[model samples]
Target chain A: MQPTSANFIANARDAIADDNLQLAIARVGENFGAKRQQAVDKLPEFDALCGRAVEIKDDVLAHLDYYLEVYERAVTASGGHVHWCATVEEACETVLRLCRSVDAKTVTKGKSMIGEEMEINPYLERHGIEPIETDLGEYIIQLAGEPPSHIIAPAVHKTKEQVTDLFHEHHRKFGKTERLTEGEDLVAEARELLRGKYLAADVGITGANFLIAETGSSIIVTNEGNGDLTQMLPKMHIVLASLEKVVPTLEDAATLLRLLARSASGQEMSSYTTLSTGPRRADDPDGPGEYHVVLLDNGRSELLGGEFQDILRCIRCGACYNHCPVYTSVGGHAYGWVYGGPMGAVLTPALIGLAEARHLPSATPFCGRCEEVCPMQIPLPKMMRHWREQSFQRRLTPGRERLAVALWAWFARRPALYHLGARFAIGWLFRRARGRGHMRKVPFMRGWTLTRDLPAPEGGTFQQQWRRRKRA
Target chain B: MSNKTQGGRATILGWIRGSLDRGELSAEQRAAIDSRLANPRRNLIPARAQVDHAAQVELFLEYLGAANGTFTRVAAEADAPKALSEYLSSQNLPQRVAMAPDAWLQGLPWEKGAPLLERRAGPARPEDQVGVTGALAGIAETGTLMLVSGPDSPSTLTMLPETHVVVLRASQIIGAMEDGWDALRKREGQGKMPRTAIFITGPSRTGDIEMHMYLGAHGPRRLHVIFIDES
Candidate 1:
C-alpha cells in the first residue's frame, strides 16, 4: 500500500459530489452515532469502563518490551514460530518464505489490516499463490480489485446494488452464471464460493486485535464464522499484527473488550470473540497443524518514546472513525490507506512520513469528536497538531499556507494591527457579498470555498465584539 | 537466489545484538522481565458467585425479549423435536432446515423419518433457516450466551439463516463474563480460543440506513431460545 492520506482532502471533496454516496453515508453515520450514544447512556459505568480500558493499555505499553518477549517465548514454547520484522517488506517476505516452506498453493485470509499495509494479496498472487478473502466485505472488495474502505465494514462505500453487479461480473469466471438480486442471495453465493477455497487452501492468514503477553495468544473478534473456518481448516495459520497490540494479561484484555464493542457498534458483545495461542494442542480434535506470528515494527519503535505515543494504545475499535465528521462525510476510501478515519489521520503520518501525509492532519476541521469517543481516549487532535508542527518544520507545508501563518503571526504580535486587519477584511467581504452574507469567492481562500461557502465573518472580529461587550 | 545473496540476509542473532546496541531499551527494563516471569501470579478481582440456573435462564430470556427475540422452552432434548415441529408448522415453512451438527443436535432425537429436512449448507441465505447446535455458557451478569463450535456443533447454526433456535443446557450456564472466559480457557487451554466465539445477546439487528430499528437485517431475523433441563 502506497500512502494516500495526503490526497484525502482532495478525494473527499470529489466523493461528496456523488449525491447517492453522500446521502447513504450521512444517513448511516447518524444512525450508528445515535445508537452508540444511547447504548453508552444506558450503562452508568460506561465512562468508568473507558477509563479502565485506557489504564490497561497504558500499563501494557509502559512494559511493552517485557510483554512482547513473554508473548514470543510462550508462543514458541507452544510449538509455534515467531518472526520479528522491522518493516512492512520484511514482514511480507517472512510470510512468503513461510508459504514457500509449506509449498502453499492457495491461501485463505481473514480480515487483517496489517496484510493490507504490506500489500500481501498482490505479493502472494505475484508468486503464483492464490489468496482468498473470506470476510464478505473483504471478498467483495477483492473481486472488485479495490482496497477495503472501512476497518469494520471494508466495503462500506459500495451499495447492495453495486455488490450485486460486482458478483455478476465475476461469478461467471468461476463457472457460476446466476445473478443475485437480494443481499441474502449474495451472502449465500459467497459462502459456497469461499468454503471450497478454505478447505483447499494450505495456509490461513488473520489479524489480531490484541496479543495477550501473559498467555502468548492472538485475540480476534468477528461476527461471521469465516475467520474460525480460515484458522481451523487450513494446515498452517499465520497472524500478521502490529507490534503495539500486546497487552500484559487476560484481565487487561477483558477490560479492553468491555469498551471495544460498545464503542464500535453499541453491541453488548460481538458475535464472535476468539483468542488463539500457537497451533492446536495434542489432544485437540481440529485445528491448524502449524501457527506463526509475524510481528511488524514498521516505525512504531520511534513512536514508543515520543509525545504521540498515546496513539499506540489504539485497539482499532474504530470508535474514532464512527464519530469523525470528516470520515462520515467522505467515508474510508478517501483516506487512501489500510486504516482510515481519525485513527488513520494520527497513524498515517507516523507510519508513512509526515512529508507524504501532511494533509491528513490538516484534513480535520479540528472537531474533537474523535477524542471524545475513543475507547483508549487517545488525544487525537493534539497528536494531529503535533504532526502539523512537524510538517511546518520540515517545510512540507505549501508556500502560501506558510506565508499566511507567518503574516498572521506578525500581525498577532501587534494587537491593534491584528484587530484592524480582521475588521477591514470582514467589512469588505460582507459588503461584497451584498446581504447574501457568505463568501462564494475569495482570494487565498479557495480551499475553504471549494466545497462550501464561508459565512461572512459575522460583521466584526471576536476581539472587537469582546471589547465592545466589556465596555457596555 | 544465489549462495552469496542468501548469506546477505541478516541472521536473527545479528538483529538482536544490533537492537541491543541501539540502546532504545534500558538495562533496568530488561531486568524487570526476569523478575515478573519468576513470579507469574498477580492479585485478581474475584468473580461473584454464580446465580442459580433457573434464574440465569429467566434473566437471559428477559434480556432477549427486551431485544425483541422470541423464546420457547422444551422439557428436554427429546422435547426439542416436537417443539421444533410445532414451531416450524406455525411458521408454515417447508421441510428445509440449516442445522449445525454439534453435540447438542446429536443428543436430540430428530423426527423419526423426516429425512433430515434439506440440509442447509455453507453461507446462510435469507431464505434458509438454520438449526445451530449450541454449547451455551451463559453470563448472568450481562445476560449473554457464549457459543463455541466443534465436532458436535457446526458454526453455521448461529448465522446463515432467517431464524435461529438455540438449545441451552442448564448446566452450561455460568455466572459472569470472566467465569465464562476462565471456563473456555480451561476447556481449550490458555492459548487456543475458538475462531468465532460469539457472545450473542439476541437476534441480528441494525438501526442504520434509517433510525428505525430493523431486526434480521444481516443475520437471523427471529431468534428462538430453547431451554433444556434434565433434572
Candidate 2:
C-alpha cells in the first residue's frame, strides 16, 4: 500500500494501458452511475437527506471532542473498550496487542480502508497472525496479493476471466482443483473457503460506517453479510475507525442513513446494516465475546478546524469516485492510495502531505461532478484548487511549468499586448496550417498532442469573431 | 506492546479539543447539545413511507422484492410454519430448520408438519440448512427487517444458515427508518439498544467481481420471509 501518488502521471498512463483494468472500471462507470441516478430519482427527499447529512456531520465535527467522549463513555457503559490512536503506528500496535492478548493465530477482516492505510495485513503477518479478508472483494485482492483498487468495489479492476485465474490459482490450497469461470461460482468457492475462516478466527476486524455516540454502536453497511459473519462468529470484534465517524445519536445516524445507501450503491439499504454496540452480552446466545474500537486520528484532527474540514464529512460512499471522469478513465489504482477519485485528490495531499502527493490535485479536470453527487456536499473542486495552491507555495511545481505559467501571466495581465500576441501567433499559424486546419505538433503541448492533433486556428480570434457576428 | 503510546487517548482528545479552540463548552451550549441528544429532531422523511398501515405492508413487500427478498404472505400467524415448509419444499431444501426463541416463532404450529421435519428454537449450528426468526420490526420504506439480538434471539440464527426464513407480523411494519427508530425506542428504553441490531434488506450478496452480484457471499444465500397477514 506504499503510495505512488507522487508518480501519479506515470501510474495513470499505466492504468490507461491496462486493458483488464479499463474493462473492469468501465462497469463501475455504467453500474454505479446508473444505479445511483435511479435510486436518487426514486426518493423525492434525496436532496433534503443530503442537506441533513451535511448538517449532521458538521455538528459532529464542531463538537467532536464532546461527542467522542460521550461515545467512549457509552461504549464503556455497554461493556466495550475504546482505544484511541494518534498515529498509524499506535493504531497498528494497539490492534496487535489486542490480538496478542487473545493469543490469536488466525484473524478475519472485512473490507476496511483504515486497515489498508495502516497496512494491517503485513503487520499481522510479521507478528505471525494470519489475517484473512472475509469479504469476497477483499478476499479476491488478498489472494491476488494486491491492495484494494476501489473503496467500495475492491476488485473492480479485475475481469471475470482474471478472477477465474486467481481462483484457479488460489483455490488449490482449499482442495478445489477445478477452475471456476462464472462470477457466482467464484463467489461460492470463496464463501465456502472463508466460512471456515470465520468460525476458526479468534478475532474479527471491521470498519465502521457510522459510530453512534448515543448507543456506542459501530454501524457497517454491506450488501454481502461478510461483516456480520466476520464479527458475530469471532471471539473478539475489533472495529477500526477514524475520529470523524462518531455521530451524536442514532437519530442522527438515521438521517445520514437515508442518504448513505442511495449515494453509495443506490440500494435503499444494503443487505445488512449491523450496528454492534458491544460484544455479546452474558445472556446472549451467540456473538463475539469482546468488542474494542481503535479510533485513529491520523492527521484528521488537524483537518477539523482547517479549510480541508469539509472532506471529513465524507461517508466513504464512493459516489464522487464513481462519477469522476478521471477516475473512471484511469481507475482507482492510478491514484496510488487506499482512496481514489475526487475525494482522494483532496484527501491524499492532506494526509500524506502536498510535497509527496502534489500530482493528485492537478490530475483533476475540474469537472465538479464529484461534488455534485457527494452526499456531504463537499466542494471537491475547490479543495483540489486549495491543494494546488499549497503545492505551488511549496515550489513543488516543475521549473518548466512555472516559467510557462509566468510567461502566460505576463501577457495575460495586459489585454492589449495579449491580443496583439494572440493575433500575430494566429496569423503566423494560419499562413502555414490553413491547408489542413490542424497542427500535428505544438510547442509546450507535446503531452496534449501526443495522441491526437490539436485543432489549428482557422478562424480569427474571439474579438474578431464577436465583432463580425455583432455587425451581422 | 511497549510501543503502544500510553498518551494516545489523551493526546487525540486534546488535539480535537484544541482544534476547536474553545477550552470548554458554555453551559448553554452544553444544554443545547444535551437536549439535541436527548430529543433527536425528526428530519425530513421520504414521503413514500408516510401512508396507511395496509399501504405500509404493501410498501414493505414491494421494497423487499426490489432487494431480491422473497416473501409469502399467510392468512394468519398460525399458518406461518406450514407456508414456510411449503416454500422450503419448493426450494428442495432440508426439512430441519433452526429458529430463534422469539415467542412468535415459538407459537408456530410445529405439530402440523407434513413436509416439514423438525424445528428447534436455539442458536444455529454448522449443520443447519435453514434458520428461522421473528423480526422485531419491518421497515416499509426500504423493505428492511430489523432484528435485535438477545438471549432468545441470537444474531447467528439470522446470519449463519444458508437460508433464512423470517416471520414478520404485518402489524410490526413501520414506515420510514425514523419510524423504525421510534419503534425501537418504544420497545426498549431511550439511550439503550440491543448489543446487535441488524437491518436485513435482502439475502447476502456481493458485486465485488466485475460488479456482478452473487448471493450468499458470507451469510444466507436465500432469504425467505413467512410474512403473516393481519386478519
Candidate 3:
C-alpha cells in the first residue's frame, strides 16, 4: 500500500497500453455510467436528494467533534466499544490487539476502502492472523495478490479469463481444479469456498457507509450478502470507519442512502443494506457476541476548514470514478493508491502528502464530469485544481513546466503582447499543417502527439475574429 | 478507555476543533446541535413513493419484480405455507425450509396447509436450501423489505439460504425509507434499536466478474415475498 502516486504518469501509460485493462475498463465505463444515468433519470428527486445529502454531510463536518462525541457515547451506551485511532498504524494495532484478545486465527472482511487505507490485511497477516476478503471482487483480487482496481468492483480489471485462471491456481489446494469459463460458475465456486471461511472466522471487519449517532449503528450497503454473513457468523464484529462517516440520526442516514445506490450502481437499492447496532442482545438467537468500532482520523482532521474540506463529504460511491474520462481511460490503479479517480486525485495528496502524490492532480484534463455526477457534489475538478496550485507553489511541478507557465503568465499580464504572440503562433502552426487538419509531430509536445495527432490551429486568433465581427 | 485510546480521542477532537478554528463549542452551539440530533428532520421524499395506498402497493410489486424478486399475494396468513410450497415446486427447489422462530410465523398452518413441506424453526444452517422469515415492513419506494434481528427473527435466515421467503403484510408497507425509520423509532423508541436492521431489495447478486451480474452471490438467489392481505 506504499503510495506510487508520484509515478502516476508512468502507471497511466502502462494502463493505457494494457489490452486486458482496456477491455475491462470499456465495459465498466459503458455499463456503470449508463446505469447511473438511467437511475438518475428515473428519480425526479435525485438531485434534490443529492443537495440534501451534501447539506447533511456539511452539517456533520461543521460539528464533527460534537457529533463524534455523541456517536462515541451512543456506541458505549449500546454496550459496544469504540476505539479512536489518529493514525493507520494505531488503527492496525488496535485491530490486532482485538484479534489477539479473541485468539482469532482467521478474520472475515467485507470490502472496506478504509481497511485498505489502514493496510490491515498485511498487518494482521504479519501478526499471525489470517484475513479473508469475502466480497467476490475483493476475494478475486486477494487471490490475485493485488489491490483493488475499483472501489465497488475490486476485480473489475480482471477479465473472466483472468478470474478463471486465478481460481484455477488458488483453488487447486482446495481440491478444485476446474478452470471455470463462465461468470456464474466462478461466482458459485467462490461462494462455496468462502462459506466455510465465514463460519470459521473468529472476527468480522466491515467498513461503515454511515455511522449513525442516533442508534450507534454502522451501516453497510452492499449488493452481495457477504457483509451480513461476515458479521453475523463471527464471534466478534469490528467496524472500520473514518471520522466523517457519522451522521446525526437514522433519518439523516436515510437521506444519504436514497442517493447512494442510485449513484453508485444505478440500482434503486443495493441488495442488502445492513445496520449493525452492537453485539447480540442477550435474547438474540444468532449474532456476533462483541461489537467494536475503530474510528480512524488519519489526516482527515487536517482537511477540515481548509479548501480541501469538501472532500470529506464523499460517500465513496465511485460515481466520480465511473464518470471521469481520465479514470475511464487508464482505470484506477493508475492513480497509484488505495483510492483512484477524481476524488483520489484530490485526496491522495492530502492524506499521503502532496509531494508523494503530486502527479495525481495534474493527471486530469479538468473536464469536470466528476463533479457533475458526484452524489455529495464534491467539486472534484476544483479540488484537483487546488492541488495543482499547491504543487506549483511547493515546487513539486517540473522546472520546465514551471518555466512554461511562468512565461505564459508574463505574457498574459500584457494583453497586446499575448494577442501578438497568439497571432504569430497560430500563423506558424497553420502553415506547418499544410492545409492538413492535424500535425503528427510538434516541438516540445512529443508526449501529447506521440499516440495522437494535435489538431492544427486556425490562421486567426479569437481577438482577430472578434474585431472583424465588430467592424462588420 | 485505555490511555492510548484516550490520547487518540483527545488528539483527533483537538485537531478537528483547531481546524474548525474554535475552542470548545459554546453552550448555545451545543444546544443547537443537541436539538438537531434530538429531533431528526425528514428531508426530501421522492414523488414516486408519495402515492395512495393502492398505488403504493402496486409500485412496490412493480419495483420488486424489476429487482428480480418474485412474490405471491394471499388472502389470509394461513395460505402463506401453501403459497410457499407452490413457489418451491414451481422453481423445482427443495420443499424443506428453515423458518424463523417468530410467533407470527409459527402460527401459520404449515402442517395443515402443506403437509409435504418440511419446515424447521430456527436459524438457517449452511446446508439449508430455503429460509423463511417475517418482515417488519416493506418500503414501496424501492421494493425493499425492512427486517430487524431479535430472538425470534434470526438474521441468518435472510442471508444463509439459497432461497429466502418473506411473509409481509400489505398494511405494513411504508412509502419510503424515512417512513421505515419512523416506524422503527415508534417501535424501539429513540436511541434504542435492534442489533441489526437489514433492508433487502432483492436477492444477492454481484457484478464483480467482468461486470456481468450473477445472482445468489453468497446469499439467496431467489427472494420470494409472500404478501398476506387480510383487508
Candidate 4:
C-alpha cells in the first residue's frame, strides 16, 4: 500500500488514457448512479432517514468512548474477545497471533476494507499462511494481484473478457480451465472453487458494516452469502473494524440498514444481512467456535470533535463515487488507495497525512452531489475544502501554486486593481484571438490550454456593461 | 504481545480524549449516554414498510420476489411439509435435506409427509442439497426472514445448503424491522440474544463480475418460502 496520491496527477492522466479500463468502467459507470436515483425516488422517507442517520452517528461520536467500552463489555459477556489496536501493524500482529494459536495455515477472508487498509493478505502470505478471498470481486482482484479499484465493486475496472482470461490463467490449479465469458458461469466457477476453501480454512476474517454495542453483534451486508459461509464453517471467526463502526443498539443498526442497501445497490435489502454476536452457543450445532473482534484506530480517533469530524459518519456506501464525474472518468485506481472517490479524498489525507495526500482535496470541483447522496449526510465538500486550507497552510502544495494563490489574493484585496487587470487581460486575449474567437494556448497556464480551448473574452466586463446601459 | 496491544489501546483512547477536549464528562452527559445505551431509540422508518397486516403480507411477497425469491402459501401447518416435498420434487433437487431442530419443526412429520425425502434435524452437511428451517419473524418492509441461532435452530441450516426453504407462520410477519425486533424482545426477553440473528432476503447472489448479478454464490442458489395459515 505505498501511496501514489502524491502522484495523483500522473495516475489520473494514466487512468484517462487507459482505454481498456475506460471501456470496462463505462459499461457500468452510470449503473449504480442511476439505480440509486430510482431507489431514492421510490423511498419517500430517504431524506428524512438520512437526516436521522446523521443524528444517530453524531450521537455515537459525541460519546464514542462510552460506546466502545460498552461494546467491549458486551462482547466479553457473550464469550467473544475484543482487541483494540492503535496502528495497522498491531492489528495485523494480533490477527497473526490468533491465527497461529489455532495452527492455521490457510485463511478464508470476506471483503473487509480494513484488511485492505492493513494489507493483511500480503502480511499473512509473508508469514506462510495462504489467504483466500471468497468474495467474487475480491477474488478476481486477488488473482490479478492488484488492489481493489472500487470499494463495492473491486474488479469493476476489469471487463468480463479480462476476468475470463484471469480465471483461465490462475484457476487452472483448481481445474477451472475453461475461460468463462458470462457472469453466471464465472461466478459459479469461483463459487465451486471457493466452496471447498470455505469449509477447509482454519479461520475466517470478515469486516463489519456496523457493530451493535447493545448486543455485541457485528453485522455484514452482502449480496453474495460468501461472508456467511466464511464466518460460519471456519473454526474461528475474526472481525476487523475501526472504532467508528460501533453503534448504540441493534435498532440503530436497523435504521441505518434501510439506508445502506438502497444507497449501495438500490436493493431494498442486500441478499444477506447477517449479525454474528459471538461464537456458537453450547447447544448450537454449527457456527464458528471462537469469535474475535480487532478494533483499529489508526488515526481515526484523532478526528473526533475536529473540523473533519463529520467524515467519521460515512457508511462506506459508494454513492459518492457513482455520482462523481471525476471518479467516473478516471475510475478508482487513480486514487491509489483502498478507498476511492469523494470519501477517499477526504479520508486518505487524514489517515496517511496531508503531505502525501494533498492533491486528493483538490481532486473535486466542490460539487455538493456527494453530500446530497450520502446516507449519513457527511459534508464531504466542506471537509475537502478544510483539507485544501490545511494543505496550503502546511506548505504541502507546490511553491508556484502557492505563489499564484498569494498573488491572486493580493489583487483580490484591491477591487480597483483586480478589475483593471481583468479588463486589460481580456482585451489582450481578445485582440490576440480576434478571428479565432478561442485561445488554444495561453501564457503561464499551459495546463488548462493543453487539451481544452479557452473561450475568448468579450469587449468589456459585466460591471462596465451595466454602467453603460444605465447611462443610456 | 498482549501488553503491547493494551498499550496501543490506552494511547489511542488518550488521543481521542485529547482531540475531543472533553475526556471527562459531566454527570448529566454520562447519565444521558448510559440511558441512551440502555434504551436505544428507533429513528425514522420508511413508510414503504408500514402497512396493514394483509397489505404487509402482500408487500412482503412482492419485495421477496423482487429479490429473486419465490413463495407459496399453505392453508395450514400440516400442508407446509407436503408443499415443501412437492417443491423439492418439482425442482428435481435431491430429496435428502437438513432441517433445523426447532420444536415446531420437530413436531411436523417431514419424513412421513415426504416419503421420498431423507431428512434429519441437525446442522447442514456440505453434501446436503437443501436446508429447511423456520424463521422467527418476517419483516414485510423488505421481505427479510429473521433467523435466530439457538439449540433448536442451527445457523448453518439456512446458510450451508445449496437451496434453502424457510417455513414461516403468517402471524409472525411484522411490518417493519423495528417491530420485528420489538417482537423478538417480547419473545426472547431483554439482553437475551441468540448467537446470531440473520436477516436473509433472497438466495445468495453477487454482481461482482462486471456488475451483473448471478444467484447462488456460496450460499443458497434458490430461496423458497412457504407461509402456513392459522388452521
Residue A168 error, candidate 4, Å: 1.1
Q: How do these models rank on DockQ, best leading?
A: 3, 2, 4, 1
List candidate 1 stretches off by more than 4 Å.
A430-436, A450-454, A457-460, B1-55, B63-71, B75-136, B141-143, B147-166, B184-225, B229-231
User: Which regions of candidate 2 deviate over 4 angstroms?
Assistant: A470-472, B1-6, B113-116
Docking class of 1: incorrect
Preferred candidate (TM-score higher): 1 or 4: 4
How well does candidate 3 score on lDDT at residue A385?
Answer: 87
lDDT of 4 at A13: 97
Candidate 4: which docking quality band? medium
Q: Name model 3 segments beyond 4 Å from true.
A: none
TM-score of chain B of 2: 0.93
Per-residue lDDT of candidate 2, residues A204-231 (tens digit): 9999999998888999999889898889
lDDT of 2 by residue, B1-231 (tens): 323444776688788878877676777987888888888778887888899999999999998998999999888877877888788889999788888988756866777743445888899998899999988889998899999999889999998899999988888899877777787888778877888999999899989987988888889999888888863
Error of 4 at A107 (Å): 0.7
Output the number of the TM-score-best candidate: 3
The whole-model lDDT of each prediction reads 0.72, 0.88, 0.92, 0.88
TM-score between candidate 4 chain A and the true chain A: 0.98
A108: Cα error in model 1, Å: 1.2
Error of 3 at A143 (Å): 0.6
Q: Could you tell me the lDDT of residue B190 within candidate 1?
A: 61
lDDT of 2 at B3: 32
Which residue runs does candidate 4 get wrong by more than 4 Å?
Answer: A466-472
Better of 1 and 2 by DockQ: 2
